[model samples]
Target: MKRYESWGRYPTIRDQKVLTISSRKAPLPLPDDERSVLPYGLGRSYGDSCVNDNNAIIDTSALSNLIAFDPNTGILRAESGVSLATILKVFVPKGWFLPVTPGTKFVTLGGAVANDIHGKNHHRAGTFGRHVSQFGLIRSSGEHLTCSPTSNSDLFRATIGGLGLTGLVTWVEIKLVSIKSPYLDTRTIKFRNLDEFVEVSRENDPVYDYSVSWVDCTTEGDQLGRGLFMAGNFSERRKSRQPKSLSIPFPCQAPSWLLNSYFMRSFNTLYYNKQLSRTVDALTHYEPFFYPLDAILDWNRMYGKRGFFQYQFVVPFDEKGETIKEIFRRITRSKRASFLAVLKTFGDIESPGIMSFPRKGITLALDFPNDGAPTLALMKELDTIVLQAGGSIYPAKDARMSHEAFLASHPRLAEFEPHIDPRFSSSFWRRVRN
Candidate 1:
C-alpha cells in the first residue's frame, strides 16, 4: 500500500490502494473489498477532499493527453489529468491562456472542476467551472455522461465543485482567454489596514483583469491588516524572450518551532517593507505573478513534518465587512501568526456549480502550522464567527470543518446530496456527513 496525502499533509492516511486510469475510455476501477473509491488528480487539494481513507484512489495522471484544440475559438479539450502547467506550456505561446486559473498551475483539470477553483480575476471571470464548456464523467454504475449547460445539466452542476463524489471526470473541455503576450502590466500598492485594502480593491478590481493581496497576520491593533495590494492585466507589449522558469526544492522538513509567532512577526515585517516604495509598477512574467509559490517545490515542508491547516472563509458583501474585521482581530489576539495570508474580494458573478465556494463577498485565507490542540481551537473560534456572519468555508482547503458548519455554509446541500454517486465517497465527505 502506498501512502497518499493531501497538500496540507494533515490527518494523514497510510492505507489506500492506488488504481491508475491510463485511457479515457477505461472502465471505472474499484477496490476488491468494501472500501469506497474516489478520483485522485494531482493531489493539489490542500485537504482531505482528494483522499479516500483506507480505500482506493483511481489515479488519473496517466490519462493526460490533449484531445483537441481550436485556436480560432480559444477552446481546448483534453483529458482531465492534464495540469494547468501543461495547458499553459502548450497554449500560452499560441496567444491563449486559461480562462481562469488558481494561484498554482500544478492542479489537474479535473481537480479544478471538482473544486470549482477561482482565480484573482474572479471578480470578472468567475470560477474555473464557468469556463468549462463541458466534460465527460464516468460513474460507478458504468454510466458515461456528457455534462454541460444543456445536457445532463443537473450532473453538470453537481460535478462542478462536487469534490469528485459524483464520479470520475474523464475529460474536460474549457474555454480559454486570448492574450497578446505571456506578461502582465502590474501595479503593487501598500495598504496599512483592512480598510485600505478594501478601498484599494474597490478602486482597482473593476479596472484590472487580476487582483489579490498578501496580508501580514502578525500585526494587531491599528496595523491589524497591513499588507500589499497587487493588480495586473495582460500586457499588450510585443512578446519578449520568456525567462527560464526555475524550481528550487525546500530541501527538508523544517522544524515546527521555526514558524513560531516571534519568527513570523520578524519575517512579516521584512517582507512588508521589502518594496520600500508605497507603490511600484512593472512588467512581470505570468509565472511569478500567478504562481510565485510554485517556484519553491515541496514548499509545504516548510510547515514541518506535523503539517499545517489552511482556514479559508468568505463572508457575504451584505455584512459590510465588519465580520472580516472581527475575524482578523480574533486571529491577531490568538497570537498564532500565519505567514501565508491572502485576502481577496469575490465579485457578484455567481457560479453554475450549486456547491461552488466563491460568492459575492470578502474571502480571507490563512495558513497556520499544526500545533495540535491550540490551532484546532483557534479554527473552531474562527468558524463560529464565520458561521454567525452567514459565511461559508472553502471545502477545497478544509480539513476539519464541522457537519453543522458545512450545512450552514451550503444551504444547497440538500439539493446536491441526491446527485452523489452511491459508490463515490471521500474522507472529507464522510467527516462532514457524520
Candidate 2:
C-alpha cells in the first residue's frame, strides 16, 4: 500500500495503486479487476478524502481544458480539472468573477463541486454548485450521465456536496456572474469582544456581498473575541501588478514554531491593528480582497513541519450562542490559539446542490498546526459540540474525522451512496460507510 497525505503532508495515507496523468494525449482508466477508484486534484484537501488505500487513484490536474463559453450570458463550460485560478486569469479581464469562491483559487472546479463550496457572497448567490448548471459524471455502471438540476437531480445534488463519492466528475457547466471591475471597495471595522462582534455582524453581514472576521481566541475576559470585521463591494480598478515573487515557491518550508500560540497572537495583533477601523479603502484588483493571503505563496508552510488542520463548522442561527460559545470556551481553555479565526454569516439554504453545507446561520473556521497527542482529542471533543447542536463540520477543511463522526456531520450522506461505485470511494467515504 502507498500513503498519501495533504499539501501539508501532516497525514500519510496507505494505498495500493496510484496513477498520475499529465496530458490529454495520455488517457488512463482503472483495470477491470480494480476494486475502487478516487480522483485527486491539487492535493489541497487536508485529509484522506483523496486517499483510497489498496484501490485505484486518478490525478486530474492536467485534464483541464476550456471547452466553451457563452459570451451572451457568461456561462462557462470546461473540463472538471480546471482551476479557479485559471478561470480568474481569463475572465477577470473581461469583467467576470466567480459567483462563489472559497478562500483560495487553486482548487479545481471538480473539487469545488464535490465540496459545494461557498464564499463571502454566499448570503447572496449561494454556493459554487448553485451556480453550476450541470456536470458529466461516470457512474458505477460505467455510464456517463449528463446530470443537472432537472435531470438526475438526485445524483446532481449528491455529487455537489457529496465529498467526491458520487462518481468521477468529467466536466462541469458553470454560470459566471458579471462584475463592475476587478477591484474591491472594502471597509474594515474593529471590535472589542465577542458580543460586539455578534452585534456588528447582525447589523452589517447582510448588507454586504462579502463579510468576514479575523478574531483572537487566546485572550480572556472582555477581550475574548477582539478582532477585525471586513465588508466589501465591487469597485473599479486601475491595473494589477505582476511579480514573480508572488508565485508559489514549492519545496520551501518554514520553521516548526511558525504557528505556535505566541507567534499566532502576534500575527493576529498585527492584522487586527493594521486598519484604524471603519475606514473605506480601495484595493488594486480583486487579488487583495478575494485573495489577501495569496501574496505570500506557500504560506501554508507557516504551519511548520507538523502542518495545520482547519476546523470549519457552521452552526444554525438557533445554536450560535449556546453551541458555538461552548466550542470557543474549549479552544481557549486548551490554549490552542489559532493564527486565523474567521466568522461569516450564511444566507438562504435552498442551494443548488444536494449535500451542500450552508444553512441559516453563522460559520466559524479555526486553523491550528498539528501539535500532536491531545490536540486531536480536543478537536474531536469540539466536533461533538458541533454535531450535538445539529450543525456539521466541513469535509474540505477536515483532516481527521471518524465514521460515526462523519455520519453525525452529514446525515444526508447515505442518500447518494447507491449511485457511487464501490471501487470509487475515498478514505472519507470509507469512514462514513463503515
Candidate 3:
C-alpha cells in the first residue's frame, strides 16, 4: 500500500489507487473499482484538497511537455504538469517571467490555475487565472473542451480556483510578463503597528510592482502588528551570471517542543530588530525576494510528525482595520505564536474564477503547529471573526473548515457546483460539501 500526504504532511492517506496520465492526448483513466477520482499534480497543496483517501487519484506529473512558445509576444503554451521552477529555469535567462507567482515556484502550472494563486504583485496583476489565455480540460465523460474567457467560458472560470473538482486540466496557455533581469530593487521599512503598515502600503503599492509584509504575531499593546514591510520592482541592472541556487535539507521531524511560544517570541524579537535602521534599500535576487522559504527543503517537517496548519483569511477593508486588530488580539491572548506571519493587502482587481480567494482587502496568513484540539479551537474562533467580517479562507491551505463556514464564505458555490465533473471528487470536497 502506498501512502500519500499533502505538503503539510497532515491527515496522511494510505493505500490509495493511482493512475498515471502520461500524454496530453491520453483519455481520463478510471480506477478498477470504478470509484470517483481527483486530479493530482505536484501535491503542493497544504491540505487534503489534493488527496482522495481510499479512492483513486489521476497523476498528471508526466504530462510535462512544452507545446509551444512565442518569444515575440511573451506567450507560452505548456502541459499543465510543468513546474514554475522549470519555466523559470528555461525562460528567466530569456527575459520572461511569470506574471504572478506564489511564495514558492515548486508548484505545477495546473495547481496554480486550480487555486488561482496570488502573490505580492496581486494588487497590480491580479490572480494567476487572469493571465491564463486558455487551457484544455478533460472531463471524465470523455469531453475534451478548450476553455478561455471567450471560449467555453463557464468551464474556464470554474476550473480556475475550482480546486480540481471541475475536471483535469491537460494543458495551459498563459501570457508571460517580460523582465529585464532576475533581480528586484527593494525597499524595506520597519513599521510600529498595523496603522503604520497600512500607511506604508498605501504610499508604496501604487509605485511598486511587488509588495508584502512579515508581521510579528506575538506582540501586543503598543507593539501590536509591528513588522517589516517590503516593496520591490524589477531592476534594470543586469548581472552576467544568474544567482546560484542553494537548499538546506531538513532530514527529519523536529521535536514538538522546538517551536513553542517561547521560542517564537524570542525569534520574532531578534528577526524584527535585525534591521537597525528604520528603512533600508537594496537590489536583491528574485529567489530570496520571492521564495525565501523554498531555500529550506521539506521545511514543513519543522512542525514535527503532527504537522501544521496555515490559517489564512482575507477581511474586507474596514474603517480602521478593527476586525484584523481584534483577531490579532485573540491570537496573542491565546499565546499561540506563529513563526511565519504574513500580512498583505489584495487589490480591487477581480479574478475570473468563480471560487477565487483573493479580494480587495487585507489578508493575514499564520503557521500554527498542530496541538490537536487546542489548535482547532483557535482556528474555529478565528473563523467566526472572519465570517463576521465577510472574509473567506483559502481552501488550498485549509485542512479543516466547517461546511457552514465554507458555504458562507463562498456565496458563488451554487454557480460553481454545477460545473464540477460528476465523476470527480476529493477528500476536501466531500468534507466541506457534506
Report lDDT (Cα) of residue 165, candidate 1. Answer: 93
| Candidate 3 segments exceeding 4 Å error | 1-3
For candidate 2, the 10 contiguous residues with the lowest summed lDDT are 242-251
In TM-score terms, candidate 2 sits at: 0.92
- lDDT per prediction? 0.92, 0.76, 0.92
Candidate 3 clash figure, as a count: 0
The per-candidate count of clashes, in order, stands at: 0, 6, 0
Q: Write the per-residue lDDT of candidate 1 for residues 1-434, one digit (tens) a residue.
A: 33468999988987888888889998899877788899998888888999998888999989899999987898899999999999999999989999999999999999999999999999998999999999999998998889999999999999999999999999999999999999999999999998888889989999998999999988888797999999999999966799999999999999888887888889899989989899999999999999999999889999998999999999986535688888888899888867899999999788999899999899999998999899999999999999998899999999999899999989999899999999889999999999
Please write out the lDDT profile of model 2 over residues 59-171, one tens digit for every residue: 78777999999989989998888999999999977878888888788789988998888888878778888788998887666677889989998888888887777777878
**lDDT comparing candidate 2 with the true structure:** 0.76
Clashing pairs in 2: 2-15, 3-13, 16-54, 36-423, 37-423, 157-354
Error of 3 at 345 (Å): 0.4
